[model samples]
Target: MGVRITYLCVILCTSCNGIGIGIDLARYPIDSPTSDEYLQMVNRARRSLAETGCASFPGFLTAEATAEAASEAAAKSPSAFVTDSTHNAWQLPDDDPARPPDDVRNVRMRTRVASTAYDELDEGGALKRLYQYDEFVQFVGAVTSQPRLYRLADPLGACSINVFRPGWHHAWHFDESEFTTTLSLQQAERGGEFEFTPPLRRSQAELAEPAVARILNERSPYRVSCVVADAGGDATAPPVTTAPFAPGTLQIFAGRYSLHHVKRVADDATRERLVAVMCFATEPGKVNSAEVQQMFWGREIDRLHVSPMSMRANRLVRSVFLMLLMISVATVVTAEEAAAEPVPEAKSEAAGEAAAAEASPAAEASPEPELPPLDCKTHELLEKVDTWSIDCVAMWLANLGFPELRTAFTGNKMDGVALKSLTMEKLAEDYGVSEEDQRKKIYYNLKDVLRKDNAAGNTNHYSQMFFWLLPLLGIYKYLTLRYEKQIEKAMKKYKKWQDARNPPAPVEIKTFDDGTNEWTRGLNRDVNLGPKKTKAEKDEEKKAKKIKTPKAE
Candidate 1:
């Protein structure tokens, strides 16, 4: 009953901590401690390492454990010593002849490493527990195929958290150890890619110049791959065969044989990358050399401290050099100013000439046509963007508040002509802009160039108008086109209704009923409506009308 109660209490304690204290066998699988399943996992990892010089296990740490470790590291980050410097891959001393002075292997490294001494960690801390776990050590040894891999005895260099803030990077360098193990706790917002070239340097005397040049020139032929965590019981996500970075994964690499670097993180990154480096050595009590300790940790162990006499000598040399440099700079500046001063004889001659010119009325009457003030707008439009370079387009977009697209354009070599020919679908595919709103923003920003008018103009009016009225015209055209069809339909309906409301008036007709028979007959012939011409003509007409009436009766 007492044993049962002890087990229950242990379970309760683990539950309170939100995760088990030791390696979660479900993920790491040391269940039988010597089971076939565990050995198979180790063998597979070893095989991958041998084949590719690197192996990764995604989700090696439980979610709860990862979170706790990240939190602890963040809390301790304020005390972390930040080192920013440039060094070659071998990290040789300045006097070492083996170190090449002009080799491409000389690269700059920048990073901030936060170290937690083994003695300082809380007894129940996740990192401490993992480091102390017997199964974890055995598992690492088995996977590395090393006869025995022991924990680093150095108090300061054993286990540490490496923090890479925005714009920071790890330079191209080989590791001091044969194998390195790291767990990625977080990732930067963008551009913290991990890249390496295998078999770059075989020995101090032998260096692969072609491969080194390709990587340094950013044109390496080897494909970069990333390990992705498997979720929902699915198989491991296929390695990102073309991308250089991976986050939230566990990796073990034989870095001594591989030349590797972490690409610089972007300046606009929102989060930094956090990684825990668990160092181990084949032999026990092995510590990093004094030079490497100073290079990476910013200080040397007491036993390896430089002699006071040598330090004083170095300081004296630096002070003398600085003093001499300042004096030389001052001398140069004074000489330049004196040389630039106008000569007295030339000044007097120029003054006499000016007075003679002023005395002449013809010369003084009309001043030379004042040159126009520099037109910055025209100059920028014609001289800058008109060059049609990819860099120029990026600058133009950056000025217009679309700086994020600058990288996309530059990467794809999208010059003015290429930008003009790009379609929305193609832009989305090439740039990875999948969001509807962001896609619209990019489309609208480049629409002017994409749909530019190419008709012959007097002075390249398209570029001029694009720089000046593009914003206003874009707004106006969008609004106008949006309502054009609706407005046309409404106008047609109104015209039909107006025509139905007003109709043409009818024609009028009139008739005369009271008419004499003689008059009617005269009307049928040629009626004479005028007064009688003479008295004889009137008497003749009266006689003719009376006879015609008698005959009718």
Candidate 2:
């Protein structure tokens, strides 16, 4: 009975955490990276992605888990934000009226899909669990060949559920992200297919404008492949080939260069098509802009306008709540142990006092402990600072008695480079660091980290000088180049004006008494005839030439 009760408690605790339960570990084995099966799975997905710009796993989630996720999405469907707008293949507004009608930029299509934003997901929901699962993230990174990947920290775009009700669809468009990961929880009764053309752009340096236009204009039937999550047959004309994807399948697609869209569900479809998009980035601190959040999620997250004090207070409340929950769990376990084997009253009292002492807040002590001095020299710290992780920074901040700033720092995904750039103003304005003294504490400590390094005759001093000097040098070079261009232009214009103002003298033809002709050009040359010839003389020469010609004949 005791063992059964203990097992029941474990199950309850596991369910409450909701971390790994959503995934099918036995089938996928993403957590076991060293296993041969894991390597095979990764390699297979990589090959598929390389060939078709997408990869799929048919049973990424268990059937039960898929049902649970579908149910959750269905419940939230009413609250989902619906969007019905016409957009171009680039997903930009048709703001450039000068663009030609045949250009892909001007070719517009309609999208009418509803979305459940990241914030709308429940903390322990199956979709959320899969999205936050470290193993799943790692697997995706492996498939995409990313050495490291971080989940998007955006309040809205991070992980969203996309709903395609009957007669609704997503238009042909390229994704802004390099890669997109999605899991299908449910499929419509009919028609809602995912159709895509292979990557049109060869690389980031060049845009395949003509090919994209072809796809956007519905002229690339041979290149189109219709992927139906529940259907097995592929088609052409509308879609070239059809592929099957069962519900619970996970797909990672390189959609940045591929033109793809979800086909409209049939008007008579019995069920809605539901898919969850899990967003990740190569770099941390990835958040959507306010405009994007508003456009998609129907609201905006004004991080700059938020109050730091209030955020800290909220953090404290959550921390206290979690602490209380832990304490309750511990009390229950302690009671169970006591019932299993009783202790003397005095011993129990003493044990309770020790536990209380350990659990008590440090603020209750006579006075809080002072922050420890840095153990490493400035130069040494500088040498290894580049390798420091976010958690390392958090611990350092905690030691400095500024644990409240951890959320702000982590939310921005600050690294050593970002830390070096942080200023008191940025802290106060962007991060809501309103308290003057707290700002000084953080800003000065960070400055000291570098200042001491410079004072200690480290390479950082020279590097810092070089960095400061670089921009000035660039500005000087740019100004010099610009000035040279202007001077050259001015000189060319002056030469042209001089040439146009002083026209060359016309050539003069002179006839001499000997009948020799001389040509004088401008004022530079003088070809002297023996004597000047009058018009009467010219007539005499003409008569002479005529007489000579008659005599020769």
Each prediction's TM-score against the native? Answer: 0.45, 0.52
**lDDT score for candidate 2 against the true structure:** 0.69
Error of 2 at 71 (Å): 0.7
| Cα lDDT of model 2 by residue, 1-553, tens digit | 1221111112223332222566777788886675689999999989988777788888888889999999999999999998887766666654456654645556566779899987778877888777876667888899999987888878678899999999998877777677889888899989788877666665544455555544554642223221212132322222222335569898898878667888879999989999998888888777766655766777776533323544676666655543444344312232321112123256687888987787757646656555343223223334434545565565557657776777777788876666777877798888887887787788767766665554452256577678546545655655566599887889999999988898678877886675555542323245545355689999999999897786645
Which pairs clash inside model 2?
229-245, 234-241, 234-242, 235-239, 235-240, 235-242, 236-239, 236-240
Give the best candidate by TM-score: 2
Kindly state the number of residue pairs that clash in model 2: 8
- Local accuracy of candidate 1 as per-residue lDDT tens digits, 1-553: 0111111111112322113643456666853334568878888888877766677777777777788887877776666667766665555545334545444444333443334443344546777767666557767788889877888765556676777778777766677766778877778888677765544455545444444444544533223221222223333221222122344466787767667767677889988777777778898777667766665566655433434554686566654543443344211111321112222354687888878876878767986675222212322333423346676566566556666676677878887667666666776788876775666566665654432432232136466666445434644655567689987898898988877787556544333454335445566567556432578998999999998886645
Ten-residue region with minimum lDDT total, candidate 1: 1-10
Q: What is the lDDT of every predicted structure here?
A: 0.60, 0.69
